[model samples]
Target: MSSDFEPILMRNVGVAKAADLQVYEARGGYQGIRKALQMSPEELIDEVKKANLRGRGGAGFPAGMKWSFLPKERKVTYLCVNADESEPPTFNNRVLMESDPHQLLEGIMIAGYATRATVAYIYMRGEFTEPFHILQRALNQAYAAGYFGKKILGSDFSMECYIHRGAGAYVCGEETGLIESLEGKRGWPRIKPPFPAVAGLFAKPTVVNNVETLCCLPHIVLRGAAWFTAIGPQGSFGPKLFCVSGPVNRPGCFEESMNITVKDLIYGSKFAQGMIGNKAVKGVFPGGLSMGVLTGDELEMRMDFDSPRKFGLLGLGTAALVVFNEDTDIRDVLLNVTRFYAMESCGQCTQCREGTGWMYKIAQRISLGAGRREDLDILVETTRNMGMMPGLSICGLPDGAAFPIRTLVEKFRAEFEQHIVRQEPGKVERVLRVLN
Candidate 1:
């Protein structure tokens, strides 16, 4: 499963004293910014655009395209680094921050220069106590070396970086929500039309990028766009850091090209290796928990930004895979997932607040053996009517809630029906036929 491709973002991860500034500099760290300093802001943006680097956050929007959204002439453009890696089991960001904090800082410097942002803020999750301290130490090292303050690396472009710890709200992972929390307000997502690119972080033009996305900047700056696009399939460019959890022999983050299939990821020698005790995989949340589930039979799909759409998932969300074994109960998984979304909702949108709660309640009843045959239908219908797809919620939290519950119920309909307790004689038969 090991390809000829070398690690870019993760090159310095396992080295001794990897987080040290001298170690990073010795490995050609600040060269990207040095090269970037010579280029105009337009050139920097164009270079990233040519690389086809998409945001590694849930959305997978093109990073360069996002940077280009800023107004042509803004006096105070801000770059908000989304370090709030709140997605469940998605600690690749935390790893990057802790293991290679300098890489992240260099990326921020490059991106800030590209966007002409005078200030950059790393919005960290409150739970990232260790990473926050490690990154703060690294920031101090960078500032002392003149890489963060004015005239970085002896260049005219100057940007200041700061770490803003959040209250660990899952909603703050959203760009607008992060901005709201940064501005000392509740972490509720603002509606679009005045999108973050136009008005963000105190009503100024802003660009919010995820930790992993920024980490790719230094590599793209040094390697060129053609080098990145050559690694993975078209539109799924660059080397990707994948977080694989659950009952796997090697359950942790691994970096590889996007050419790897979901099957390869689970069973590949260089990746997760195989399931624990050789147990059969019942299902996998190939992306994050919210991106929906892939039945065991669906493991042939590739792990890419585009592949999941064909299989009815939300998208390649954080590229974090959580696998479950055959002995596990899909109903319980749904209940747990629904309960999380229901609790994490910002309560800004009626659909998300009410829909997630109702879904969780129905899932709870199903898990508790009190489920009605019609409960399954109600869950599916509720998901369909809520979220951005139905234009019902302010943010995509409802959409996130909908994907897993809907996919689990739709794909594992029989399992859900079997849990209905056979309260009525003909009810189980009717439930089985609902999909037919």
Candidate 2:
């Protein structure tokens, strides 16, 4: 995997005053919006459709198709920029919002025009207090520069932009859930059928796109769909920001194409720069805590929307890699992931509300040496009983909860069983030592 690729989104991240409007302009900022304002909104949407830019916010949905879902007869259209990057071990959106606020705003403006939206709200997570301030200043700058207010860039199209800080609820990352929070209510996911495009934020036709998804718009408009599609394979095009953390030697965000493999990310000098301590790798949580772990042998799996499925892992979720060395315990890994999904459930659906807690406690018992042989059976079967099936829960929270535990228990069943295997006291002691 050797090629020359430049960073598009993060090109200005390291420059001093990069967050400043002048610095971003010196680097060719807002050129897309200028071009976009000259073209019809349908033209912008068609370019995105041709580019095949999928949503970077875990779901991998097509951006253009999502925008097209809006009804043609709606009175008002809204664009909610989902800056709530609450997924564990994922913070790439914060860098975009804090370092290059105008770029995000430009994307918003481009998307606003495409969706025929009159207002845009940036639903930033409360934990992103600093980014919030940075984005607010950028919004002010953009408005003062005639880039965000009425007749943006001297065009007839105008869209208002604002930011609302969420109380750091993970559920708000879901589009409709973020919509509810924006309406000054609890961040609970709304049932679909009147999907966001049909009925969203304040019951207006709304489009909820992730911060990264919107950030790509400026580039798509300026560089054209041909340039965008040339970056990666069909269906998974464009630059991706991967946040590699958890015991890596160089834990930082690296921008790369979607074609990069997990092995390359962990070992490539331009990426994580290999694992810390030179220890053997036991397992890897390839994408934050939602997409389940990939065993050390599965490192060769391609980092894309479809490749991970061959290994019983969910799609490249948030592209946040949490690596664990061979010294780590499998039971402990399951416990931590199970506990996260459990704590984050919004308690909207009965099955998700209770099943998440059940899964967490079961994994905890396994980690604490209180698990029995039947507990493994209980764990596997419990996943099915949960309301993780589509339409059961208000959103994908339950499925997000069930998928990781189901895959973890199923894939690592043998290793999990060894913890409860009681041969002789001496044998169990030796096993524990080897595991540790």
Candidate 3:
């Protein structure tokens, strides 16, 4: 893949004082908000609709369509900026907020204006200590610069922005759960019919958008919808920020078009620059740790919203890839993945709580050299029936939990069976070898 494409979201990233308001303004920040302030809310919404800017927060829902869901007669509209980037191996949001705070604020302002939202709350994870301070300072600067106040930039539109730090709950990354936490309640997902666009945040109409999704609005407004749509393939439009981790030569975040393949990301000179030690890839958790894994042979899959489905994945997820070398143990991977979901379940839905626990225990036993062939069947059965896909949970948490475990077991059954088969005399040594 060519590295000639200019990065829109991260254009100012490595520059000196990129997070400073003055530096951001010098680099053409706030141009989008200025342009947006002139347009009618309907017009802005229409522009985004034409641009096809989907939510970057795993759901891939159309941002304009979601904003359009707000009732025309509502008294107040709330905008919730979901800054809780809790998905494992996903830190693109943090990079954006920390590197160019004004850009994110600009995007939030544009989104707030488009949705007719009078107030915006950035629901950030509590653990984001550094980014939080940087964003807070940026918010202060934005307010001081007359970008947020009674009348922004001498325009009739007015909006307020605030940051509400969440106590690092993975479930809160879900919109409704984020809304609940913003209300100072336990972070549990709300049953729908009254989606957030209808009643959210103090029971008022709200729009919850991810950090990266909002960050695209500024570019769309400045360049025009057609320009935005032309970047990537249809249905997966615009530039995407990808995080590649593990034993890659250069494991970090990179902004690229969705047309890039998993293979390209791992081996492209401008991306991960091939796996470390020139080892063959064993498998890849192509979209964070939850979306499911891609076998070494499946590296050619396109890194896009729709392409992952063809290979039995849960969509592009956070577009974060965690690569494992051929020397890695599949059993250890399964156990670690299952354990994360087990520890993170909010204990709300019986299926998710108990089912994740069951999966984790089974994975642990198998990893500890006490595996049986029947355990695999039990794991598969539990995952198949536990998530919203099967009508068993209230939110998509179980679905996220189930996909990786099910896919890992099904795709790497041979590796799992090996663990079970070798659980004899040298089982202790085998387990120790994996642990070390």
Better of 2 and 3 by lDDT: 3
Q: Please rank every candidate by TM-score, starting with the best.
A: 3, 1, 2
Instruction: List the candidate 3 regions with Cα displacement exceeding 4 Å.
Output: 425-436
Worst-scoring 10-residue span by lDDT in model 2: 423-432
TM-score of each: 0.96, 0.95, 0.97
The CA lDDT at 28 in model 3 is 93
Superposition error at 372 for model 2 (Å)? 1.1
Query: Which candidate ranks first by lDDT, i.e. highest?
Result: 3
Q: What lDDT score goes with residue 360 in model 1?
A: 81
Model 1 lDDT vs. the true structure? 0.89
Q: Tens-digit lDDT track for model 1 on 362-387?
A: 77766765677688899989999988
Please give the RMSD to the true structure for each candidate, in Å: 3.7, 3.7, 2.8
Please report the TM-score between candidate 2 and the true structure: 0.95
Number of clashing residue pairs, candidate 1: 0
Q: After superposition, how far is residue 344 of candidate 3 from its true place, in Å?
A: 0.7
Candidate 2 deviant stretches above 4 angstroms: 387-391, 422-436
Report the C-alpha displacement of residue 17, candidate 2, in angstroms: 0.8
Q: Roughly what TM-score does model 1 have, to 2 decimal places?
A: 0.96
